[model samples]
Every structure is written in structure tokens, then in C-alpha cells.
Target: MNDVVGALAGAVGMSHVIHDAAAMVPYLTDWRGRYTGRAIAVVKPGNTRETADVVRICASARVPMVPQGGNTGLCGGATPLADGESVVISMARMNRIRAVDGANNALVAEAGCTLAAVQQAAEAASRLFPLSLASEGSCLVGGNISTNAGGVQVLRYGNMRELVLGVEVVLPDGRIWDGLRALRKDNTGYDLKQLFIGAEGTLGIVTAAALKLFPRPRSSATAWVAVPDPQAAVALLALLRDRCGERVNAFELVGRPALELVLRHIPAMRAPLAGAHDWHVLVEVADALDGAALDDMLERAIAGAIETGLAVDGAVASSLGQARALWSLRENISEAQKIEGVSIKHDISVPVSRIPEFLQRARAALTAMWPDVRIVAFGHIGDGNLHYNLSMPGAFDNAGFVARTGEVNRIVHDLVAALNGSISAEHGIGQLKRDENARYKSDVELDLMWTVKRALDPHGLMNPGKVV
Candidate 1:
């Protein structure tokens, strides 16, 4: 392939090596334009020693290597397979931000920065980088630590593998592994940055990170409730964490066909509450103490969850533009279910008391096998995670509801593995759940994930096929 695109355009230079198939068409598709492939080039590399010299010339031309970022992956794991051999490595030009420290709250960055520029460099150092997302302005903190990303403050700061701490990676023999270490206590031996944070890059190339930072809440509260299902939104998220204790930062559930597809395609989305019920949660409460009585602790916890019935109506955001218009009806239900079409997304995760018995057995086994299917449930029910999508009813035809997405992902990943959940909770099985994660993982968890992908990609050549 032109000597591996002339050694990745002589190691990151022919203007960041794109090899025109129309400038490698947006790093050859993903971000749910599902997958697309073919790549004899796409390189970009502007740091970590030119991404370890383009992974040592594609590990000496054995070729394969995918590691993309900000391709906003929803499981094509930054696409690239249909056997175009491989070579994507586009960490959005290693967009730097290299250090923030603010008395060791920690920051470092660069694995192409934007998780909203590391939450605006942890709010310009007054700190707080609680990985909030809905693609925090185009995902990338190395694809949110290569998909350890679970957002909506993972119910207050946790995941991006616990707000990372270190990782530099490069490995598939091009050896770099700096293990960044912005130390928040380390016991050393084999922490190995939790095997390249979420190993979606098969086991290498994360190029930068140190992460972790917090303390910027300074009082907040936002509500939206109206429940009566999903077990009264998990009993009003355990009665707002027992009357707002750890300051419940985000609970989020939103159903009623994901708020009627964000009030029919989100332009001035309304309905905070006036009728439709069937479930909705969207809670929030933060602190760090400036003006501390957070709106009288969100009006005495929504008047004691509507006098103990666990909320059957609520509203609370008297401004921050009505708490961003009640978080734009739960962040515009995945852009109005991508303009009302092609849906069959799963992103599961159970056991927060099995999320109302996994939404009543995945909506009674997907409406008893597609009986005019159209679930469109919602997510982060305070972290039992669900985006359990489907969409097709209104008299179907979005290519027959995306041709029944493999029978609606085998009845929603076989009832999310019978409630042991997670066919992929924070979207990272790429190649759309790699053969359904090899039939729901476990040949001893896919042989200890192929023994850590043959101990750091022993020639599987980085992101080959993907995730293991």
C-alpha cells in the first residue's frame, strides 16, 4: 500500500498523512453511521513522539492499528475493518492541554483533549471534571478513556475508570507506556493504567492522560420528576439518596418513549410535566457550598417526594435557563433518536437493584417480540445505565426500522444477559458488539480478555478486529 502510505507519510507529515479517499472520509465512519472501512492511511499523530512513530511504522508493516478518538464511538469502536487491512490512529492531532495540577487535583490531558476540553481544563482550575457527557462536545479524552466512559456524572464522579489518573500507552511493540501517574495513591505492580484504561484499542495507543479533579459544584439543584413506573423511578432514586445526602448529582431516567422523542425532535422541547407520566426522573443536587442551601435543599427534597409517594410530579429548576431547559428534555434523546429513524441501540447495565427488574424484563422481552416495537427507554437511572432504544411503530419504515437490527439485538442482548446486564454499558464493544461480545463473554471472560490481548498486543497489531 504505497509502502504503507510512504511510511505513514514519512512518519506524520504529508500533512498528517490522510491519503485521500476523499481525505479518508472522516476517518472512515463511525459515530453510529455504523461502520465503514478501508484505510491505507489516516494517521494524524502530532505528539507522544508522533504517536510512537506511527506505532513503529505500523508495527513494521504487519499493518493493522485503529486507535481513533472523537469519532464519537457508539460501538463501532472507532470503526475500520471490512478488511482494508488498517491504519486509523487519528487522535485528532493530539490536541494538547498537557498539565493543570491545581494543587494536585490533577489534569495532564492530550489523547486529543475535548471531553469539552477536559471540562474546560477543570473549569480553569477552580476544579471539577466530573465526566458529564452526551458526547461532551464531541467525545475524546481518548474516547473517554477508551470507553470506560459512563456519564451523567456516573451518579457523581466515577467512571472514565474512576476519572483516570494516568496512562500514556503506545505499545503494540512500538513501546511507550509512560503510565502517566498523577498519583492519588498507587501500589504500583501491574496497575498498568488498568490495561490501557478500557482496552478498546485492543490494548495500546492511548497517548496521554492523568485526569481526576473535582470540587466545583458550589450549590446546584435541578429536578423534573413525574414517576409512577420503572418502580417509581427506583423509588425516586432511593428517595433522592435518602433526602439528598452525597448531594445526588444527577439521577436521570426519562421514559414515556424517551419523552416523546424529546418532544418530537427537540426544537423548543417542552413538557417538564403537565400530563404524560409513565416515568421521568432527571434529578440533580450538588454542593461544594457557595450559597449552600441549594434552593432549600431542592425544596425539602421535592416536598418529601410528593409526601412520600416518591414523586408523581415535580419541577424545580427556577433558572440556569430552567436548568438548561431541564437538561433539554434529557439531552435531546440522542438527537431525537437520530431524527426518528434507524434505532436499535442497547447500552445496557443493570443491578442498581436490577434496574426495576431490568425495565420489567426488557419491556417484556421487547414488547413480546416486536409488537409494533418502539421502546426508546432512557438512561443513567442513577447509574444502572440504559439507553435501551428500539423505535419503529408509528407505522414503520425507516428501512423497515433498520431491518430489525439483528432481531433487535437478539431480544435486547438476551434480556441483557438475564439481568447480569451489560452487553456494553458505556458503548465499547465496537464492530457493534464484536460478535455479540463473543456470545456474551466468558470462556473465562474471553480467556482473561485474551490474556490482556496477548500481553499488550503481542502482534495482534493494536486495534485489529477490536476489543478482544
Candidate 2:
């Protein structure tokens, strides 16, 4: 281990290699603080060549390697194990925007570049990168690619997998595979870039990527609408799609409890509607042409929905500031929940049509099991994903409730399975959901995953005890 650390320090400056237990704490823990790991050292490589060199040293030493970017993962995928035998390869120093091809509608960004930086780079070229997440300011592009992250705009722009044109990865054996081609249609052989997109670094480490871009939207309309129930919210989505077509950008569902948490914990946040509603949705529509009448279209659609019983009350943002304020209410949910207390969070998704039924059944089953359990539900309902969380109001009981995470997950994930849904929609199967994933997946499916893992990382040295 000392030899390996010395080699890494030689490859990338000694300042970039940190072995001190105290200084490695930030890289050793996860964002949710549910996991804290130990490492021989945390290495920061400046570029792709330096990254490849560090990997070569670790591979030669037969040491396990964990590729981490930003360390903002909710799942403990980026965190090392407590065995203190692994080397965490932090990509934070590799942050760089290599190039922007305006004509091709693509840009190349290093693994360590923040999501916000990439968005800004695209905007400078008069194009748009539409992967918008609450952690965009701090999360890195490599982590987004590794997790195949999905956010609010997935309703229109799709997930990170769809947004990526190609990738540059360093294989487990220290060979660099430069597949960073910003081409739209390349149909010759296997789509190798996809193997690492959501593999969580089990196969290899992604150094950089060529991401797709889009025409910037010149006009957008946002609305906060109160619906009678989940079914109504689902219906409202369909109605908006029918009337507005592909202009619909985002449609988020927020439960009453979720909103109340935001209003209570998030500063200066108030309910959009005057009356206390059981459920609400934040809807957005955008177009490329300026003065495209998006507001009028959304207003007419909302009015029609109310008349037809799809929505009870609605408030459309008349200014950009108002639109941002409305969005803050949806974006601040996770932060508010965190401020309130620790809770068991499930990021699951079912078919779009079955979302309502899943919500109804999950709520009923949970309440029946624990009558006092507070259910805070919200997510990209437009894409069928829901952040269903559970917590007790009292601080004393909440700790005990968190201890029953396995029981709560069984209830929620079993229902998600019954509804033909996924246990993890956007978040990868990190250490947090590894057992649950194994429990839900079929033997044959698990076998195929293992096959891929063995084929790519035969030694199981790339991010051990994760995904597989």
C-alpha cells in the first residue's frame, strides 16, 4: 500500500495524494451521511493521462479502486469500504471544458466539470444542456454519466444517457478507451459508451464525455396547479401534453406533507395556492421562438383542465422571478426534508399510467402499518419517478423509525415490483440499494449483470461491493 501510494504521488503531484485520515473525511463520506468509509489514500489526478497512470499503479498492485466525482452521490457508490484497503480516485482536479462544437450541437467536458459549468458552456454557444438537478451547482458531469442521472427536464430532454454523445474512459487495466466522438449517428459496431454510463464505475472510470446540446428555449411558462388527487395530476399531465404537445418541459408532483415541510423549513417559502390542497404539481412549457404564446397556451390549458375537473386551482407565473420562486418550492423539497430529520427515502418509478394507483396503494399500506408515519412524496411525475420518503414527526421516534428502513423498503419496493416498476429509477444501485436490487432482480437478470461485470472487470477491482 505504501509503494502504491508513492507511485500515485509520483504520477500526480504529492499534493494531490492524501493519505491522512483527517483530511480524507470529506471524500470518505456520502452526501446523505449514511455511509463513512476508509481508504489507503484519496488521489486527485489532473487529466486523463495522469488518471490512467494512477490506475496502472493500483492495478499492478492488485488494489481495489473507487472512482469518485464531486462525492455528491446519495447512494454510497462513491464511498470506499471500511476495510481501509482501497484507493479513492477523486476526479475533482480534472475539471475542464475541452471544446464546444456549435455546429454539431455538442460539447466535450472533463469528468470533474460541474453540471452548472457545462450548462453555462452550452449557453455561451447559444445552445442548451437540459439536465437540471437541484445539486447541479456541486455535482460533476462524470458522476452524472456514471449514474445516468435524471432530473425535472427528463420529461422532454431525457436522462444523461440520452444526452451523452460519447465518452472517454480508463479501463480497469489502465488502458484509456477514447470513444469521445460527438456524432449523432454512428452505427458500425457495439455501443460501448453505454456500458459505463450507469455502471457506477464497476467496469471503468469515465474521464470525460461528449454531451448533446439543444436549441435554447426563448420562451417558457411555469404554473403551480392544485389537483384533487394523484389521479387528477396524472390526468392533468396527459391533458397538457395533448394541448401543448412536446413543449411541456417539466411536470413535478408534490404531496401536501412535502410542501408543508418546505414552508416550515425553507426560508421565505409559502404555498402557491390560498387553500390547503392535498396535492399539487409544478408544470412548465418551453419553446425556441420568442413570444411563442406559451403563457397563453398554458393558461388556456389550465383553465380547461379546471373546467373539466382535472385541476382545482392554478397559478401561472407571470414573471421570470415568479417562475423561479415556484420552481424553488419543488427543488427545495429534499433540503427541507433533510433539515426536518433523517428519513427512509425510496427513489422508485412505475409506468406513467400506474403512478396514481401506486401512490394510493403505497399510502394506504404504509398508514395501516404505522398510522403516525409521515409520508413525504414528490418527484418527476411526468416520468413516473417518485421520491417516496417516510419519517416520524417526533425526533425521539424518528431515529427508531429510520432503523426500520428495511421494513419500510420492503413495503414500498414490493408494491413498486407489483406495479411493474423499478426499485431505483435514476439513482444507481450503490451500496445502499445493492441487497434490495438483488432481492428484486431475477436470477437470470442477475446472472447477466455478473457476466458483464466479470467480462469488464474480471478481478473485481473496480468499485468492489457495488452494483453487482
Candidate 3:
């Protein structure tokens, strides 16, 4: 172990290689604080070459390598296991925006660059990189790519996988696979870049990426609408799409319980509507033309939805402050829920058309079994994803309630599988859902995933016990 640490220190210098328990403490725990592990050392490589060298040294020594980014992942993808035989490769030192092609509307950025930094770079280049998430300030692009993170704008721009055109990765064996071609079209053989996009670093370390950009939206509109049920929310989404077309940038669903939690825990968060409704939809539209009559468009769409009985009540943001406030309510759900108490959360997705049935059946089944459990369900309805969460009823002890997480997960995940939905929507399987994934995934699918893992990382040195 000392020799392995010495080799890593020699490769990246003593300053970059941290073996002391104090220095390794922070990297040992995950963002959610659910996972804590011990590592032989935490190595910070300056660039792809250094990263590759460190990986090579570790591989040769039969030492496991866990590639980590900003450590803001909800899943334990960035966290090492408790084995204490792994070396965490922190990518923070490789922070650099390699290039920004304004003409092509693409940017090549290192793995350590925060999502916020990438967004700022795109804005500076007069373009848009629309992957927006609550953890944008701390979540690194590499982690986002690894998890294939889906955020608020996924309804319009898709997830991290869609935003990336190419990737530069260091394979598990320490070879750099520089497939960073920024072309819009390339049909040569297999699209190898995709394999690592959402592999959660189990296959390789994503060193950098060539990301796709879009024309910046010059005008925007936001609205909060109350719907009778999930079906009505889906109908409202269809109405907006018919009226506003591709301009519908975001469409999030906020359940009454979720909104109530925000209003209760998050100070100064007021209800958008006077009375409570079973469901609420937060919609955003954007366009490239300034003074593009977005307000009128939003008004027309909302009015149509209301007239058609799809939306019961609505409020369009009259100012930027109001827009921010509305978004705050949606974005702060997880934080607010955390403050509320221990909750069993599921980041799930089904087909857009099947969302209504999923919610209906899931609610019925869960409520029938656990009558007192509080279901605080909400999320990106446009993308058929929901942050379906469960909290203890009334005065139950939070810790005791949390102990039933496994039972709750079995119920929810089984229902999700029945609906042909993913147990993990935006968040990767990571360590949190790996076992659940195995239970839900088909035998053939599991075999293929293991096959891929074996092919790329035969030694099982890269992010072991994650994903496949």
C-alpha cells in the first residue's frame, strides 16, 4: 500500500497525492452522506496524461481506481467502497475549458469544470449549453456526463448524454481513447463515445468532452399552473407543445405535498395559488427573438389549457424576480424534503403516455400497503420523470421510518419495472441503486452490461461495485 501510494505521489508529485487520513476524509464521503468509504490515498492528476499515468501505475499494482469529480453526485457514483484498497482520482485539478467553437456552437471542456462554469463559457460565446441542475455550482461536467444527468432543461435540450458530441477518456487499462471529434455527424463504426457517457466511470475516466451548444434564447416566460391530476398535467403539457412548439423549455410537476414542504421549510417561499390542488405544473418557454411576445404566447397557452379544463388555475411570472421565485420552489424540493425528515426517494421515469397510469397505480399500491406514508411526489413531467418520494406520516420517528427504505424501494421499483420505467431516471445506479438495478434489469440486459464491463475493465479496477 505504501509503495502504491509512493508510485502515485511520484507520478503526480507529493503535493497532488494525499494519503493522510485528514486529507482523505472529505473525499471518502458522498454528497448525500449516505456512503462513506476508506481509500489508500486520494490522487489529484493535473491533466489527462497525469491521470493516465496514475491509472497505469494503479492497474499494474492491482490497485483499484475510483475516478471522482466535484463530489456533488446524489448517487454514490463518485464515492469509493469500504474496501480501503482503492485510490480516488480527483479531477478537480484538471479544470480547464480547452476550446469554444462559436461557429460550430460547441465547447471542449475538461472534466473538472463545474456545470455552472460551462454554462458561463457558453453564454460568453453567445451560445447556450442547457443542462441546468440544482447542483450546477458544484457538480463537475465529468460527473454529469458519467451520470448522464438530467436537469430542468432536459425537457428541451435533453440530458448530458445528448449535449455531449464527443469525449476524451482514459480507459481502465491506462490508454487514452481520444475520440473527441466535435462533428455533428459521424457514422463510422460504433459510437464509442456513448459507452462512457453514462458509464459512471466504471468503464473509464472521462477526461474532457466536446459538448453541443444551441442559439441562446433571447426571450423567456415562466408560469405555474394548478392541475386536477397527473392526467390533466399531461394534457396541459400537450396543449403547451401544440401552441408553443419547441419553445417549451421546461415543464416540471410539483405535488401539493412537495410544494407544502418548500413553503414550510424554506423561508419566504409562498404558495403560487390560493388553494391547494392535487398537482401543479411549472412551465417555461424560451425563444431566440427578443421581445418575441413570449408573454402573449404563454397567456394564450395557459388560457387554452384552462378553457379545455386541463389546468384549473395559473399564474404567469410578471417579472424576473417572480420567475426566479417560481423556479426556486421547484429546484428546492430535495433540500426542503431533507429538512422535513427522512424520506425514501426515487428518481424514476416512464414513457410520457404511461406517466398517468404509473402515478395512479403506484399511488394505489403504495397507499394500500403503507396507509400512513406521505407521498411527496414531483418532477420533470415533460420528460416522464418524477422525484417520487415517501415521508413518514404525522409523528412517526424519522429514523425508524427510514429503516423501512428497503421494503419501500421494493414496492416502488417493482411498480416502476411493471410500467417499463427506470428505477433511476437521471441519477445513475451508482452504489445506492446497484442492487435494485440488478433486481429490476432483465437477465439479458444484466449480462450485456457485465459483458461491457468485463470487456473494458477486465481487471475490475475502475469504480468497482458500481453500475454493472
lDDT of each: 0.82, 0.95, 0.91
Error of 2 at 366 (Å): 1.1
Q: Which lDDT value does model 2 have at 394?
A: 98
Ranking 1 against 3 by lDDT, winner: 3
* Candidate 3 per-residue C-alpha lDDT over 1-468 given as tens digits, one digit per residue, 9 for 90 to 100: 989988888999999999999989999999778899999999999999999999999999999989999998877988999989899999999889999999999999999999999999999999999999998999999999999999998988999888999999999889999988999899989999999988999999999999999999898999999998999988888889999999999999999899999999999998998887889999999996554499889988898888889989999998999999999999999999877766888999999888889888888987887777788988998999999998775546556768888988888888888888889999898999989988988899999989999999999999998987
Residues forming the 10-long window of minimal summed lDDT in candidate 2: 288-297
Count of clashing pairs, candidate 2: 0
What is the full ranking by TM-score, best candidate first? 2, 3, 1
Off by over 4 Å in 1: 12-44, 48-67, 70-72, 92-95, 98-111, 114-120, 127-139, 142-215, 219-226, 230-251, 254-282, 287-292, 308-376, 380-386, 389-468
**Runs of candidate 2 exceeding 4 Å displacement:** none
Candidates 1 and 2 compared: the better one by lDDT is 2
By descending lDDT, how would the candidates be arranged?
Answer: 2, 3, 1
lDDT of 1 by residue, 103-183 (tens): 889888888878998888789889988888877887788888887888787887778998888888888888787888899
**Cα RMSD (Å) per model?**
17.5, 0.9, 1.2
Q: After superposition, which runs of candidate 3 have C-alpha atoms over 4 Å from their true positions?
A: 394-396
**Native-vs-model 1 lDDT?**
0.82
Error of 1 at 317 (Å): 19
Candidate 2 lDDT by residue in tens digits, 74-128:
8899999999889999999989999999999999999999999999999999999
